[model samples]
Target: MGKCIICGKPVDGLICEFHEEDVVFEFEGTSPSQLTPGRYYRGTVDGYADFGVFVDVGDHVTGLLHRSELDRRLESLDWEPGDTVYVQVLDVRDNGNVDLGWSIRQADREFRGSLIDAPDGEYRPGERDAEDESSSADDDSTTADAGPSTNGGDATPDEPAEPAEPAATPTMEIEEPDAPLKRTTVDALDDQVGSIVRLEGEITGVRQTGGPTVFELRDETGTVECAAFEEAGVRAYPSVEVEDVVALEGEVERRYGDLQVETETLEVLADDERETVATRLEEAIEQQARPETVEPLADDEAVAALENELVDAATTIRKAVVEARPVVVRHSATADGYVAGAAIERAVLPLVRDQHTRDDAEYHYFERRPLEGTVYDMDAATGDVTSMLEARDRHGEQLPLVVLVDAGSTVESTDGYDLLEVYDVDRLVIDDSHADEAVVDAVSVAVNPTLAEANGGAVTSTALAANVAAHVNEAVRDDLEHLPAVSYWEEPPAAYVDLATEAGYDETAVTEQREAVALEAYYQSYKDKRELVADLLFGDERDLAAHVSEQFRDKLEAELETARENLETTSIDGVTVATLDTAAFTHRFDFPSANLLLDELHRRERDDGPFVTLGLGEDELHVRTTTPVDVRELGETVADAVPDAGVRVVGGRDGHVEFLVGERDSVREAALDALAETLA
Candidate 1:
């Protein structure tokens, strides 16, 4: 018997079975199932497919390197049909199909040690006699007489053996009781740099880059990035996930002015150890996240009544940043929605930079997605879930915390919320819409005016988000104080107007930022345009905001002029009803979209005496009134008057109604008659 190289335990071979899988292995097996999962192997490119690439691990075993498992796209791969590549055997299916994963290390020498995977398990190259075979020819000129006895005693009868195993694995002793380790907190790591340190903490984040897999470990004191690598793009500790309480042993090293632990060994704590660590982390986080006193941004009774919910929303965002969870802010593609989303983005990005060591942590941890509509429908939630799942599975990223700003309030978003609920992804909705009461209870934190017993008409999403943003960080309150005023299209709230004026933003400047953000929100509706938006809202120079707002005014004014020229007015029951042929007059595809143009025209040219500006289009009839009109009531009126028009209240926030294009004339005539009778 020989001593196991790693644990120094007496065994049949030099290495034990427990540590055998830790080293890289060379494949000598013929069948695909014979190969071990989570082990790297040399492979040759067999061919490429539209979805993925096929690689031959050995002569008879071929595995598929799925495109989803790649760090880059399949088209970017430079490998030809015959090029050799290194891959990790992710799984060996029961049907003898091998699923291969990408490896950054192209050479075997980059790994710790080499072994051969056999039918039993894994072992050294020459350990199994049946697998190791060599022969000497006449031209080889081997000495018949033994010079130094090169063959070991384990050699076969017909063949000579190689030398005894060399010392490759480290010498370690396994005691009856585990050895006690000297542990230190993350805050004290700076003093232990370049020295071996053991840390007990929770894994806040796990990210697999092209090189090492970085685990953001957090203790009560602070957080540090621990990088563990078996091979590139391969999970170093596949069993360890985010939120796991682990005890990691490594040497603390500083890279690029940041402290990183070069992990040598990591173990997930269990039972007592896990409970102790988790309890300590929870206590610390609770104290840090909850402020002793939450000071409301404004002295309004309505805002004060929502103190608990606002604090909860801020705490959720702060905790998400501290834990390295990606924060996805989904908002409507409008001035108020973008402002609300940008307020949270401004607060969270600074916290993200402070919490994580990654330079692009803001981009990776926070995403502001401008939704096409004001509802978090299933389509939007499905897309978000798919992208986040891909990021988690392929890149080892933590599942994100979705922050619904000005969305996820109505009953229509319930299905979308349920989809995210299936993944157990934490969601927080900060809106001022007329939300279904069920939606308020469905989310982790819902901060809506309707839920707070406040009139939803007076509270805009930007106003609510700005209040929450102040409590999220409190440092960016001045930067975001002007945002609430920018969300108002008509008469501004006195409090928000005063707040903006105090923060050096006059009515014109607030209008400029509002119009600038609205115009920019249309382009790249998919992306948040972080830098451009930051410049427009929080930039030092007002010139950029002025320039963009000039474009906004130019386009909106041109559309308004066209609408005025095409205005078709009629007196019905002494009510001045103005109608605009939206299809022929407005620039359908250009800036100041249909809704914006109609809002502006209705704001500008509507006469008194219960004015109604009806924007008549092919498929939609958008209504704007000088007085508050219950949309559902008007929809019922129009539908009763014109049964074939199929008029429906499609938009709740703006009193928007829709009708069939085939019944446009009937719908318009009935709408005019309904307005005349109601006014009379």
Candidate 2:
């Protein structure tokens, strides 16, 4: 019988059945049948195949470590042929096939102790020599009892031999005290793997996984994950949370090619030590977050006019990343909005990856959400509050910095911005619309050309965002050169068109990309679709854009044909007014939404003369005009004409109004009359 290494209890082998999984085993047998299932073993990388890798267990046995069993991507594995690795033997088939699974620990010392699995039995490495010596001692005792004594005296059976002197009990020697543990920084942990280290830093994030509690620790140099476990699926150090200064001792380990710290002891720092770490982190973040300069992508006076505001906005975003705060971007569900949001996404993702140590920091630190319209209403604000609160309670995350791009600039968004203010969440707005003066005080930073007395009507939100994105990270400036042109449905400015042309995107390509993004935005309007959008705009896959654009063209043409066939035209006060009952003519729940179809139909019918297109839905009215129209003012006019109709504008700059379904005819007639007087 052997003893369990952990509990010190005698068992059938080196470990009890309950603790078998804790010990690692070495295979000494020559055949696959000698492998024990559900136990970890040391193996060598024999070779790799498309589906899995082949690991050699012993001299004559091999195991297949399938890709499905890997916790990470198979291609991410750095193991080469003949390199040592650790894997669990999941099964040994009747036909001599060995199946292996992934093991979290790769080092031998990570296990309690190793036992050799020989052809005959399992034993520790030096147990055989100890057993032989024990047998020899027993034989010597037997010989001495049966033969005459060494003193040369005959002893009778009744006579007892002289008692042997009791062997002296061994005394433990006291050694000198151990040296104090040296402090190591996160950046230097790579060179100290498999060794104990002490670190002092501030905890930026804390997450609970199935078996461990992972705390994201950030020092002056970088960030790293430190895992502590109290038990299976239980929280460790429940008092620790984000933004707390801590001193930790752990073994530096490599898990799935990423450096991790297996925490042994973690303590919160107080007084001077805590202040020291916090001050160091704050100083580093401040110095790294501020951009040295703010430069526009193109030579545009409109963009250059807002250079100071752009620098402030860029500084806020950069500082959020360095401070480990999430950036939540909210944009309108339109072509321009998507382009604006994607440009910022492209710039911020690289900064997130560079500032954090985890591979998934980009996803955690940056998020993009599409708003239904140009207004950030209370519904969106409520949803954002709920999600942010949940994240804070569950993961100990700090409140995110909400960024409004191409949206949330008018008075309609004031209530939403007010709700966010109650939580003290930071907000930044980058828009080109006629922003309400009150909005300037609601957000942290407002970057709008109207506030600077620039030509806001001619500037698209994409232009401002692309310029700000360039300032955020100058390295991605070339990647955003063509974005401004994609936001314009009509003829873009010559400066932007020339910029896109110089960036290898012709007019046709820009149009196709714009159409494609608009079509995708209508579906899953709330989702960001970060990867798909990135591929369509920045990836090398040109065919993907063409394919999606073709679908967009087909859908729009179909909707436009139906809309034109049912169109009604009238001239009031020398202004042409075209109307369509979109509820009866267009597909309500599919592609080519009422707004998009109306825009296309009006584009086809409008000439140099003043034209207005009204797409009447069940309870809403969408207006598209050749002349600038204030839907809010139009709503007030209609409300006066039809007092019972609940006339209110939903989308501010996009020109959307809502009324009672029963008063649709009254609202339509009143809206046309109001448009005629305004346009005349």
> Model-by-model lDDT, in order?
0.79, 0.86
Worst 10 residues of 2 by lDDT: 148-157
Clashing pairs in 2: none
Summarize candidate 1's per-residue lDDT along 326-403 as a digit string, tens digits.
899999888888989999998888888777654445666788888887778889999899888866765457788999
RMSD in Å for candidate 1, one decimal?
Answer: 13.4
Tens-place lDDT per residue, model 2, 1-680, is: 87887788998767787777788888888878778899889887765543567777775577889888999977578875567889999998775678899999999999887888778877887887799999999999998878777335666657877766788999999999989788899889889999999998888888665456778888877788898988744789999989899999999987534588999999999999888888988898778777887667777888888989999999899888877888999998888899999999999999888777655568778999999888888999998998788667656678899999999888888899999999999989999877778889999999998788875248899999998898889889999999999999897888899999999999988998998899899889988988899999998977888899999999988888888889999999989989999999988999987887887888889978999988899999999899999888889889999999988876565558899999999999998889999999
How many residue pairs clash per model? 0, 0
Could you give me the TM-score of model 1 versus the true structure? Answer: 0.72
Which candidate wins on TM-score?
2
Per-candidate TM-scores read 0.72, 0.76
- Score residue 622 of candidate 1 by CA lDDT: 80
